[model samples]
Target: MTIFTLSLFSNPLYSQVAVIVHATNQQALTESDIKNLFTGKLKSFPDGNPVIVLNLPEGDPNQSLFNQKVLGRSDAQVKAFWSKLMFTGKGTPPKEVTAEEMIKLVSENPSTIGIVDSAAVSDKVRVLIQH
Candidate 1:
């Protein structure tokens, strides 16, 4: 399959996504862990390693799918959620990156977690969740 790195400008294609971590990452993530990671609730892995989270732009298909299926939030809701957290100084949001950058970032950072189209799963990263 092709490595899925479609630009964020593209329309939502309803494709599945894989939540990935660095290949050396050995965490067995629960659904709660996935949600907490994306939602800014869980800031670090259980071992106290900082969990650096990444995201595709809001309109990206994989971003939408992951937010809906995993985080149970729409783009608007997610935006507002982060906004409130930022304003309240409660939490910081994931950095928005292009799909290609996401793969590159996760590949390079053992502490990072990112979402990409399922078809994009590669040797550079390991899938923690697929939907």
Candidate 2:
């Protein structure tokens, strides 16, 4: 079980991360929009609908890759950034969730967005962008 779990996390096939929203959502979000949403900078869709952003736990493989490729920062840096924002009463980081929950919430809520491994994506959620 330990080896299986380790191999799952280390697999290159799952290295690609996908940002997803509700399947019926038609929002066209750019990379900057994604970065801002994840960073607590942008809170709404172009239509002015507020979003509920979800993230995988800190250090999760997909989360780490998303941070590097999309956010252009390390996981620790992201944690620190949120910490400072919270301390200064400026922002709140997205909620941390498992990959399964990400899919569940995003699929169920049109106003929600979240990340998951590219391979884990199902028809339940719509892919906004991948990184």
Candidate 3:
């Protein structure tokens, strides 16, 4: 795999790293799905129940990288994106936690998925898809 840098209109300091989620729960998540999930447009997996996506807390390095590179937004932009969606009753932003907490949450909650630096991956969770 290769890492590529992304320079968005707003944030441009994203690191090149694979953002991974739980493998078994989501076979393959399109870029749109990921964007929707982050933006709160889509809730739940292909299944009927609500899907809980975990994210590292604000200012976290991995979170910054994942948002800019994978989600294509800076923290402020992401907040604004969700503000619009949530106000419209279209979607809810993923729950945010610390990196370690997010990892543990994803590892225990079958329906929970999170993004993290590839180097931080462990056997605690199954890597579903990467981008």
Candidate closest to the true structure, highest lDDT? 2
The estimated TM-scores of all candidates read 0.87, 0.89, 0.72
Worst 10 residues of 1 by lDDT: 1-10
Collision pairs in model 1: none
**Candidate 2, 32-62: lDDT as tens digits:** 9999999989999989999999999988988
lDDT scores in order: 0.89, 0.92, 0.69
Off by over 4 Å in 1: 1-14
Model 1 TM-score is 0.87
Judging by TM-score, tell me the better candidate of 2 and 3: 2
Steric collisions counted per model: 0, 0, 3
Task: Give a tens-digit lDDT track for model 1, residues 17-87.
Answer: 99999999999889899899889889999888999999999799789888889989898999999999999
Q: Candidate 3, which segments miss by more than 4 Å at Cα? A: 1-18, 86-91
lDDT of candidate 1 at residue 37, scale 0 to 100: 89
Q: Which ten residues in a row have the lowest lDDT in candidate 3?
A: 1-10
Q: Give Cα distance to truth, residue 125, candidate 1, Å.
A: 0.7
- List pairs with backbone clashes in candidate 3: 22-128, 23-128, 44-51
Roughly what TM-score does model 2 have, to 2 decimal places?
0.89
Ranking by TM-score: 2, 1, 3
* Better by lDDT, candidate 3 or 2: 2
